[model samples]
Target: MASPRDPSKRTPEIESWMNGADKLERLLDRDKFKAWGFVIYRCTYRSDSEWEEFIVRIHKRVEEYLGYYNGLDLVGSFAPTVLEDRSFEGATVISLREKFNEWAVTAIKEEQGIDPSHLWHLKNGRYRFFIMVDQEALDSVLSTPEDDIHEGFVRLVNAEWKPEELDEEELAERGGPGPEEEPLEGCTEEDVGWMKVCWGHSQMPGYLQLDGSFDWDMYYSRPPVIQSLS
Candidate 1:
């Protein structure tokens, strides 16, 4: 896989934030990313309900965004305490986190579905959340001009809420296999005879473990952007 974009290669604006020496120093000292690749944020919450509300609001926001760019994977969760040192390399991790937190808090407050009464101490620990883009998918997204990318993100965030409506016929069509049934051609008496011989001497386990390594280089890489929708 391509190494993360070198901080030096970033635009002046991005470079300035990426190379914030003090912030990097502090983050490194904290040993964030020690586990599951995460960084620590000392969040102070007003109450438990507020924390839960924040999560629900962000979940909806992320879902909307993911729908726009089907290729990207934007999953998030709340951790009891922030993980150590999990910021994106060559980027302003803290600033990005703060921006997301601000947006989420504001959205939660404005949306009636979110209840602030459950807000609790982020003081118990910081919550760690993340949004990651597959490099290949990101490359495709970035091929568009920077301005358009920003606009896309905005549209995702401000998307109007709509109730999901299902068409009964369509739903039934997707529900399962058709009413007609067919016999398995490969399971004839001859095939069963060969199978018995093959398995006569040994038993095979039902499952096998898969190694996790995968080829990420095949995908494209692109810079992240935020867009606004009119």
Candidate 2:
């Protein structure tokens, strides 16, 4: 098994998306565009056929990249169930997302011996990925002090998104925000720690809270690159 901290195990798109999403979270200051410093790019294919096609390509591509069993054990484990039914509507998206998140936790714990309850889990929207963290799980560990948890939690999610990265350490060290600095308009001091606090529940509502709605016209209708093996 690759080290629980293997960077090679993560796909490039996921890594790219994570970096972009983390920056967005800090800019937006609400943790609105990310789940654990990463963005889950969702397929917004308009038709059931399009959705199927996208999934098939990902299956082939991911399997080829990570080996058949390896891919199946990761996101592939949840892909079949979502693919079995060709509809990627609101209710279906919610259901599969919840299951995928749960299963990822179990998978990570089994494969790497790391507790995913603290790290963020990615959602594989056959068409569209969500920048959603396991909010309920995060809340459950509010008191998960930085020192007590494994350093791998941050790296496991994304090296760019640890508590130290998001917290006020730099500002504290430098004295504070700039002279003209002001807190985000309506947000509070605690609100700034949106990523750090325990909201006590998965604020993940229906499709809308997380922009959970499906807009089929918006998907990038292309195929993931499939590698050819000798």
Best candidate, TM-score: 2
lDDT (tens digit, per residue) of candidate 2 on 1-230: 43333232334333323332222223333322222212232223344554444334434433443342233233333222232322322332334455445555564455435466533432322212232223232222333442222111100011121122334887888787644323432322321212221111111111112222232112111111111111
Backbone atom clashes (below 3 Å) for every candidate: 24, 8
Q: Cα deviation of 154 in candidate 1 (Å)?
A: 16
Tell me each candidate's TM-score.
Answer: 0.19, 0.25
Report per-prediction Cα RMSD to one decimal.
23.1, 18.6
**CA displacement after TM-score superposition, residue 106 of candidate 1 (Å):** 32
- Residue-level lDDT of model 1, residues 31-124, one tens digit each, is 3312111122313233445434433433444344333333122232222122223343223333445554554454334532333333221111
Model 2 stretches astray by more than 4 angstroms: 1-45, 63-102, 108-170, 178-230
| lDDT (C-alpha) at residue 154 in model 1 | 9
Q: Could you give me the TM-score of model 1 versus the true structure?
A: 0.19
Superposed by TM-score, candidate 2 places the C-alpha of residue 40 at a distance from the truth, in angstroms, of 7.8
Write down the RMSD of candidate 1 (Cα, Å). 23.1
